[model samples]
Target: MAQFDEVFDWVVVGSGAGSMASALLMKQAGKSVVILEKAQWVGGTTCKSGGVMWIPANRFMNPGEDSLEQACRYLDAVVPDGPDSPGTSPARRRTYAVEAPKMLDFIVGQGVKMERGSTFWPDYYDELPGGVKTSRTVTALPFDKNELGKDWASKLRQGFLEVPVRLDDGMKLPFMKHSWKIKRIFLKIALKFVAGKLTGKHWVTAGAALQGRMLKAVLDRKAAEIRTGSPVSELIMDGDRSVGVITARDGRPWRVGARLGILINAGGFAMNQAMRDRYMPGTQAKWSNGIETDTGDMHIELAAKGAQLAQMDQMVGFQMSEAPGWDTDYVKPGTQSTTGKPHAIQVDQTGVRYMNEGGSYEEFCENMLVRNRTVPAIPSWAIMDQQYMDEYGVAGKGTAKKNMEKWLASGWMRRAETVEALAALIGVPPAALGGAVARWNGFVRSGRDEDFHRGERAYDNWLGDPFFKNGPNQCMGTIEKAPFYAIPIVPGDVGTYGGVVCDCDSRVLREDGRPIPGLYACGVTTASPMGRVYPGAGASVGPSMTFGWIAARHAAGLGNQFG
Candidate 1:
């Protein structure tokens, strides 16, 4: 038995989407719950994210378009099996495929509104078996933070987009310069912004919308307590079972007990340089966009208590370029959306065009790290031409004179009159770069990428210039326009993908394959159920919230509601 200053039916560490979901479920079950957040704000990294949840066969999807069998097949094809991918064992994968939709239904039943993502938002590998060209992604509608009241709204973590825009709006906003449809969408968003201001509604979109709605739902119940700036330092153990945790209150050590279980939704170690060096080498913490509170303190505490940690090397890579103010920005400008656009290509330090520039961000950065094993490619260069500058711009910035000068002055961007001169500026062999450009131009003319199959998938085309008039292929365009430019791209991550291993029930598991009683975990705190593969949008948040639901149900003795 452990001494405690307070007790609850459920104690959740971290105020992420998963933590909030579990706390909500516990409260609904008539159990007392508390959420302890290390950060001063609620909503964790999920609030700072795009807030898309990948739920196959969701209610919003057309009936018969997706099913458990189909989703399982897709998972089987993409997520690797065997001991190497122990986190995504056959049983766990099946459980996720089945329970994900149920989780969505449960969340919605609790009054968290959601709708399907873009119809054009295809799976990364749509050509694969069981893959859907239509989206399985679900996202919350834009929410008004004013509903949360001033104090609670002030405590909510801010996201990238302040204005209320749908997730699909983000997909189309990049092409406002090209398409009439995008321009109309932009006009609508602007009008909505004005109307919202007049109505005294402070709207927020993306992750903030999802989290704001959830936070409102949680607070509306008024059954669960949420404490910020309270970090769970250590777990209180009785024999092999976790009974409580040691956290802080009023700058003093405070002990809190859990009558049911303690759930660790405390996120990953993307901000911990020591852990990054040990697990994911050739990566820097500064490049990561994970929230500052994601220092993996819970991971260390879990490991110290004999929890088995696996797949620690994997990260949810979101390839990024060093923009003028990248270091200080809330969400760094990423090159993932830019490198795949027209009139641009990615190459190693030796000026050789490598993997396909378009696809999932995880695969993009995985290829970068893998290529670095053979070539000096850690800081790969994204080579572009004046046409790209004229149309697509660089790292989400316009090609205005001021923006260009600012980038050039900061050395974050380089430009030259010729391809060879550009290569020289970026420290690559001029001849090799020139040859690569010539080869890419030839491919654009032939409409085929013999080297890496650049734009064969629906996803690749989605990341491309839809309004490109000169090329037959949306992703393939001549990089020959004068005043060539180069921007160095690194394998930046949204969050690390690996941590302590858990079972299908979301119970923390030991090396011997036994569950640590009263210990549950979800989100990035555990090795992800997707294994090394990023299936589609919201893969991380989807599993995190689903498993959090599962953990709560198991703790409450609900006995697998989906089962």
Candidate 2:
């Protein structure tokens, strides 16, 4: 019923992983599709991420290691099932478990190269029932951006890593100073760099590689029409059914109609200070590492049309330290390495150890926010000794004389000769600080964290020093050396977690549980199907792409192929 300047079988908003996947599926079905991106760049916040997809029972996994049944059990154990977590119902979880691998296979069939992530990258809750000790994650190999051609390559969003290092290699790079295995990995990376230069290939890794490969495939097929800087301002509703959208083109409003449905893959509101204050209070937008365009415009539009929004307060928390220039850096230096490494422990303002330091980034920041409700733990202090500074350094930077002097001068880090003096500098009670340090030291001696069980999980040890010889537990080491240091750690996030809720088929649902016909959504634009818990690495991206694929299939009259 809406007048249109253009029409397509499917129209996707936001050119993220979900958008790309959905468009690819539509193309495979010979349906006309258009992808509209608000930013000048094509990839969304996904481009700035570590492009990992947690696909359980994927084809690349070793036989007998994973299955759909086990994956469902793991989801049942970890993801909450209640009114508050409606996005992660048993049915939806089952669908995700079953269809995720199919999505991976489809992408691979389309010529995007993918491989299993590190075998050591265990699930975040691997100790739980149905959890795997080894990785179930999938990632794209390092891609040559030249494959996309110069025009498309220039429009692709840049990621944190430009070198051709795999995600596992990047993870191990931090330990190069300690382990011979890491040194060999470094040598291989050096060879890769030389090889790339000689071959005249501009290689990219991480998120960029994943997206670059997908984009190249899409262009090669020439099926979906992709447009950038086209922001969808309104969802054109034909009496409750989303029939089209009002987007900008040529500096004017353009009406685009979809014969099947409009999929909203727009990102979350991590960069919007107002939304952050309303949903997740005590968090600052400046601390978030999400893309600048993730301002939640589509979320507001969807809610205005009676769509149910849930889990508004949840975020994929990435704990960060306020290093010099952290506010302006493309990728803020994270404290996950700092707290999880040896000779370091996080304490509250009252100078007391609260939670396990070597847990997942989501839990790390969630614990900090929850602790802030009673105690002043928003900016928790990470207490470390000279040994930690000498070995692991602080916030991913080497603790050279110049770096330490700069940090000290800028008030980003505090240092002292004794625990008492360091406590005073960081505004903590001296007795409490010294007592906490002594307690931690005692745990190191016994090789057991009786207070919080820091090193009990394989994940904890994976994040710690693998070659630590002095300590029985990889994450347990005495913080007793001289020249103690303290740095403030805050609850930073990759993106917000809450948005309009969707069903198993990726249809946007209203408050009364009825689907809004001709409407679908994926990515952070929808409330996460994993509920409030992060299952493993790439949880967000895996679901986003899978649901996107599901949406396209359903629109094309193919109902739940895997189901």
Worst 10 residues of 1 by lDDT: 393-402
Cα lDDT tens digits for candidate 1, 94-200: 99999988888888988999999777788888778899888999999999999999999999999878897898987788778777888999999999999999999
Q: Candidate 2 at residue 236, lDDT?
A: 95
Count of clashing pairs, candidate 1: 0
Best by lDDT: 2
Clashes of each: 0, 0
lDDT of 2 by residue, 100-160 (tens): 9999999998999999988889899899999988999999898888888889989999988
Residue 299 displacement in candidate 2 (angstroms):
0.5
As a TM-score, model 2 comes out at 0.98
